[model samples]
Target: MLNIVLFGPPGAGKGTQSQKLIARYNLVHLSTGDLLRAQIAQGTELGLRAKKLMDEGLLVPDEVVIGMINSALNDNKQAAGFIFDGFPRTVPQAESLDALLAQHDTKVSCMVALEVAEEELVTRLLERGKTSGRPDDQNEEKIRKRVTVYNTETAQVAGYYAQQQKFHALNGIGAIDSIFAQICGIIDQHQPATSESSRQATDEVKA
Candidate 1:
């Protein structure tokens, strides 16, 4: 499976790019934020807990996030691959993800990080807040705090992947298509030859 870890700070356009990548690569979208929200919507015990943390702009516990990802992986056994968004934020979480994927005999194909300036992120998020109805987005202080947390606590995860030569960073300030093309180039380089053949066969069958 061609699993990818999509890395970026908030307002880096990960959600938009993930949709495009999913369409192009037939990857399942495993967004931790979405998963947490689903639990919240269901009013589960975990949801209640996660909601409290999230309302305060705090991250949910790693174990809870990993469990949700494990369930997603199990549910999508036939997926072409999975694009992980808003996950594996800390180095330990990255380690856990590596172990989890190992149990499935597949590893992260690559980690693609989007590089955006903090000011740009703040502006974009504030604009999104006008329509997104997300309190975190509307509050500039919360947005900056989140970015700082990522930098101080989560940025090291990139080094973990880089040591394995499976990390790619792209400029996130350009046109959406331009940035996507850069990401696709990196993915094409890492994609296994067998996966190409399998995709072709699947396409042929569809045709």
Candidate 2:
């Protein structure tokens, strides 16, 4: 399975790029934020706990998020691969994800990080807030705080992946298509080659 960890600070275009990557690669989009929202929507036990924390302006526990991810993995057994967005925010979380993927005999093929300037991120987020109506995005102070938190906490996860030689960073500036093409180039480099027989077998199955 071609698992990818799409890493970046908030407003770095992860959501937009993840959608494009999913469409192009046939990968399941496993976004922890989306998963938590779904859980809350369903009023699941985990979701209720997460909701309470979120309501209190606190982050959900890593275990709860991992449980949701585990469920998603189980639910998509037939998926060609998975694109993980807004997840594994800390080193511990990244370690947990590695262990979890190991259970399925798969591993993170790469971590693609979008490197954007903080000023650009703030601008993008403020513009997004105009329509998104997300209070956090509307406030410059909060936006900067979020960026600081990512730099101090989540950015360390990049080093973890780098140690494993699976981290790729790209400039997240310019047209969306151009950035996506660069990302695709990175993913293509890491993508495993399928033998002709395996390709034929997959085609036959599709047929």
Candidate 3:
């Protein structure tokens, strides 16, 4: 399986790029944020728990989120792979994920970090607040806090993957298509040559 983790702070266009990658690669989009929101929307026990934390802009407890991911992976073992967004936010979560995938005889093949300027994130959040009316985005104080939390907590996972030579940084600025191309280029460079289909997919995008 072509396991991929998409890492970025809030408002960095992770979702937008993920959707494009999923469609092009036939990968499952396992966005933790969406999974939790769906659970909340459905009033599932897990969703209700996550909702309380999310409404306060707090990180959901690692175990609860990891449980959700494990269940998803178990149920979707037949999938081509997964694009994990908004997940593995802490070192422990990342470690747990590695173990889970290892049990399946697969591992995270790539960890793509979307490198966006803090000012860009702030600007994007403010714009999102205007259009989406999301309470978290509206408060500059809260936005700053979230960004700080992301840097302090989630950013370290990049180093963990870097040590394994599985981390790649992609510029999060530029036209959406251009940014996607850049990401595809990184993946293409790393995917094994024996994987002809993945190579073709990347080439098609580059073309």
TM-scores of the candidates in the order shown: 0.92, 0.87, 0.93
Please list the C-alpha lDDT of all candidates, in the order they appear: 0.88, 0.85, 0.86
Worst 10 residues of 1 by lDDT: 198-207
Better of 1 and 2 by lDDT: 1
Give me the overall lDDT of model 3. Answer: 0.86
Writing each residue's lDDT as its tens digit, candidate 2 over 1-207 gives 889999999899999999988877789999987788778789998788877754443467888888888989999999888999988899999999999999988999999999999999999999998997556768888788888878998999999999999999998877888787777767766776744554454344334
lDDT of 3 by residue, 7-81 (tens): 999998999999998987788999998888788889998888887777677899888888888889889889988
Please count the clashing residue pairs in each candidate, in the order shown: 0, 0, 0
- The sequence of per-residue lDDT tens digits that candidate 1 reaches over residues 1-207 is 788899999989999999988887889999999988888889999999998888777889999999999999899989989999988999999999999999888899999999999999999999999998878889999999989988998889999999999999998898887787777777877885646654554344334
Model 2 pairs whose backbones collide: none
Supply candidate 1's per-residue lDDT for 147: 92
Better of 2 and 3 by TM-score: 3
Candidate 1 Cα errors over 4 Å, as ranges: 194-207
